[model samples]
Target: MGDTTIAPPPTAQRRAGVWQAVLLLAGSCMPVLGSVLITPILPQLSEHFGDTPGAEVLVPMIVAIPALMIALFAPFAGQIVDRLGRKTLLVVAMFAYAIVGTAPAWLEALPAILLSRVLVGVCEAAIMTVCTTLIVDYFHEERRRNRYLGLQTVVTTLAATAFIAIGGALGVGGWHTPFWVYAVSILIGALMVISLWEPTAAEAGEPEARDRPAKVRIPWARIGVPLLVTLFGGFTFYVIVLEVSYLVVGTGVAADDTATIGGVAAIASLATAIGGLSFAKLSKLGHGVLLPLAFGLQAVGMLVIWIVPGLPGIGVGAVIASFGSGVLLPSLLTWVVAAAHFADRGRVTGWWTSAFFLGQFLTPILVAVLAAGLGALPAAVGVVGIVALLVGAAVGFALRKASAAVAA
Candidate 1:
């Protein structure tokens, strides 16, 4: 008779122990930091490039280049990740980020800055993609993994919040102090090599098959819903990232006052951090309700600020929007992803990633264009709400289709 033996699965979680989790989380924060650190310094850079339209556009390019490249290269990062494992990629990418991330400030000319941004994006692709893969290797239960995703979002928000104050202050000294934060990646890079463990397939207990719908592609319905959710979330984020200062300025607040402007941006991001941490309570509501609520609240918040126009008004709007995003992002993502088969998850996600990232890249350009004729940043924020409403409709329709398809 053929041998008949079935090993029992381990009860322990698949994720790394706490210390390992901390180090990996820190590694994941590098890309977020590298991106946020540059925000306060963009105005300074615009001045450095001299007064010209091409160079002004270069400022946005420097920021957008990394985001765009990361979107494009994410798949390649996935393909290689299987061979190198997560730690190897994290280590290499972190070190590369530390070195190449700051090269732009050291050089003169806009082209150089754009080049540095592209390289930084490449490193970012590796770091982000690998860190996510590692999380799956470490966590086993669906509920725990969803919670971890919330934690990851919270961590990224905290990094952005902490770095904004630091980077803003550093920019006060000169545009380059903010860039120093990029060096933190080197330590994380090294830690990945020394501290992170490589558990065998059996030890890790990854299962015979994993469910993540993002493989080569997935049901258009699945990809479409999440893609809309992310796209709307990103468009909301763009209001803060590219235009908060401009909004403050256009609204007649102290636009020229760098300290106050930075402080306000920090406040907006703080709302995001709070929202991220507080999202746990709402997870049980599932994606269907949360996504639209998030988008609607954020859109309404934007509308309020658009009509009222002040710091207090802006702050209230930001918190509401942030809370909605905090609830919506993880809930929708977890719901769909929990249903995904691992083989197709990456590819299915490739489309979502591509759409979400494209939104991040396009937001500034589109807003800036709208601002050119619309007369101020506030108009741009309001105009974009139309798109957000469409995303909400998509999310609702997607949930219906996914449920029906699965049932059949």
Candidate 2:
């Protein structure tokens, strides 16, 4: 009989273990900090620049600008990441994020502040792309990668909560106070230099693969459909985060109370964090089981917010929706990453990141369109909820067929 043996797949050696995880997770928080850190004070920032032309539109740009830039620049960042390596770009991006992110503190001109925010977004694109790519890099196993993805969401959500609270408190001083929070990136970047070392497939015994030319054909069909789905996923996920403060004010719940708005946002974030924590265990159910639940919950939550009135109702809706959003993120991320080739991880992830932030950038505009036709923001939210329900049902139906096919 012919001798037969199965060789195990190569595994990357742990470079710095827990410290590496800690630093990357910490770095991950920086990308989101851009919006959450300043959201509570947006009204103030708008007013401060009100006397200057276009304050109405431009003030809000501070929140969306970074997201837009991330959408625009992330693909390029991914190219750099795949070719140049993860650590160097990440470290530079982190340092750049700190400097550009803090520019609003001293800048007096409205246009100048907007410029800084745009620059901050560029850094965020690189930071988010590289950090996510590294998470996949550092962990080879599917379950373990899923776990870290969950952890990454958890840490970012919690940090958003903390930063929102801090921003609210600091807004008592002035809108500029919260901009100081970006300085934390300096420390994170420093820790990265100290603790983070690059890992390669060669180190895992795939020298031939590593030595292959960088110019390889992308498996577009594999990653493309998911990227497209995640674009909508991104749209749905960011609705509450970007619009809840406005919703609270519009509903007559928290009139000019940044602290209360911040508190509500934080609670919603907590719910998302809770959902994220469940991904590892729940993931075994697979997309067929999970997507419906995630979208279904979100639709119900949005419907609740629409039909019910008052802060308590909104709070309940927010928490429920946030949970769905949390689950949705890691689910989509894990799906896309798993489908991608190891060599294409960075660029594929960059496209994925771009899709996500692009959704974020489009959210307010889409909501505005709905609001215009629907007659009110809450009504628009309800209509959107119905749309989500339809999407969920459709996905559930398709998944059932797929599952049946597999069983058959």
Candidate 3:
């Protein structure tokens, strides 16, 4: 029989350059901004609203509400992206993000500020979903896509640290001062307006078979395991990021010693960034290798924290586990979105985002509960590490078996 492979139409040859990638990456940081920029000012916020009812609870929600919103609304944003298009939603969301994210700066009432945070979260959902979706769309080639995805992790991790510093510096002016940082999005949104374009189905390289009238469905069977794994990955990923300060303080370091705590945390963050930078080169090993390796490193790191006493163990273990987390994120992302077609990419990215943030949102609560049950936070962390080890082993064995079967 004659060969029947068909090349993509010339219209599908749209190529994205460094500028577009840069813009999309900057856009991706919108959610990170929503997440971390207000953290340093949480105490200030609590102090200001100290007299308000439930201020204790509601004050913290200003930092947390956005992640919750992303978890709940990212899928909806994905639907809109898939139906309405990526660029418009992203552009609109970025502009809206600047508006809502800065509202707390001028708002007088606590309830009003919280409401503004909710809107910030909503915009974040759209921004993150669209940014990720567009990245995959713009760079469909495996090597290029993997590199950028890995860079996404690196950029965001480093951005978190920078935002924290900025927030602290701005917080010197009062809780409201840090909020002005949100206006940075306005500049990014404007740049995106000029630099980004709506990728056509052809440009997304839609396959000939997918052109039929058949209703497009999410490839849940293909993505279910990855998404589930991502949920757990998300939890493990944030453990060091969220709890390292407490872990340091637990080791007899003063809570007020921001230098020691911040230094340890910064080292861990650097490790994570290093791991993310390495992934593009290592991704050739495939998920079967990378995922298990990442999880195992995390397990070992956490185990070190549980076993080794004092600051040495905490610092070393945090760095190791954070590096693993850095590698783990992009791996999970590429695993989910790799085989997705143009029609379904937005929803796939959305669900993956939702799964991850949901896991992040649950991390503190689950760790708290585990701490209560175990009587020590390190013990709880060790327990989670053990689970990660078991998961890694299972994934490795399953992938090996599947490979063997395919060979046979």
Candidate 4:
């Protein structure tokens, strides 16, 4: 038996470590950079393009187009990742992202700059899909995968806060300066080239993969519930992030009091990061316990904002909701990906990415609609919180019934 045994190929035996995790985590932040880095400079962009037709609407689109693109294109990027392979698409997307991301620095026309943003979003789609797919591929162990997914949320949440600050600072030099920040991807892409390798089929636990069919149909039935939940999770997650500043002002803090506003926003962001970090430990409680807790915390936080009144209420509520969102994100992700096979992992991830970002893109619109109907923004948020509470209750009940059936 010893004489008959054979060794796996070096590629199959290759294992990911801290270096790979670091690069992939950093790569995961590219979409966040695309989304928020330019937000602080939006007024500058508006001033620069003030004369252009529809500049008011178009200027904000510069900040928004990438998310729309991610929602629209991530599934396609996943198809490419699954069929073509992950590393190469990721590398190409990163390089492309740098080029387009920096194009706004020199472009004169508003339309041209917007076009660059659209392309930037296209690159972001590939970057996000590939980065997430790779993270799962590299880490197969349950605990390790869950930890990094939680870290993905923490890193990106923290990065969004940092980018906002950096963008504001760089805008002092003109909007063009922040455009240069896009070039950071070039450096990351270069490092990925040196440090990362494609995971082979054997590494994906399919040692006999050569004999399997080229296409593996995605297990949509298993993933559908999680994806639907993720869409709502995405919307709820951004509710605090997007509305906190407005909530602060509504609390009677002057909008121009950037110091007070930024401080509150930063605290909320830190709470989100803490929640994400905590998920690695808390995930062992399983989704049944975690999801309800995450959503309940969000409900409580938002309800506090609705009922408690003023900045103290808003601040406390935002931090609680943000933390719940942090927990919710990774929980949804792990739930969706837990059943994915290597063959369809890319597509599954792509759909999840699409569902989540689509929710993000819709958050503002939905909140606005709710606000109009309710007569106040906080009321709208409160309504959403109520919905979240109900959803969490439903999920907990369903899980309990399923568990009881299995036990029987």
lDDT of 1 by residue, 240-288 (tens): 6567777767656765797777677767766766666656666666666
What lDDT does candidate 2 reach at residue 406? Answer: 82
- Which regions of candidate 3 deviate over 4 angstroms? 1-12, 207-210
RMSD values for the candidates in order, in angstroms, are 3.9, 4.1, 3.4, 2.2
- What digit string (tens of lDDT, one per residue) describes model 2 on residues 61-106? 8888999999999999989987888899999999998899999899
Give lDDT tens digits, candidate 3, residues 181-265: 8999999999999889998766666657356554478889888988899899999999989999999999999999999999999
Q: 1-408 in candidate 4: lDDT tens per residue?
A: 358767776652788998899999999999999989988888888887889889989999998888899989999998998899999999999999999999988988888988999999889889988888888888878888889999999999999999999999998998888999999999999999998888877776667876778898988888888888889999999999999999999988897899999999999999999999999999999888899999999999999999989999999999999999989999888888756888888999999999999899999999999999999999999999999999998887877787789899
Better of 1 and 4 by TM-score: 4
C-alpha local distance difference test of each model: 0.67, 0.84, 0.91, 0.90
CA deviation > 4 Å runs, candidate 4: 1-12, 206-211, 406-408
The alpha-carbon lDDT assigned to residue 39 of candidate 1 equals 76
The clash count for each model shown is: 25, 0, 0, 0
* Cα TM-score per model: 0.84, 0.90, 0.96, 0.96
TM-score of 1: 0.84
lDDT minimum window of 10 residues, candidate 2: 201-210
From the highest lDDT down, the ranking of the candidates is 3, 4, 2, 1
Candidate 3, after superposition: displacement of residue 140 in Å? 1.0
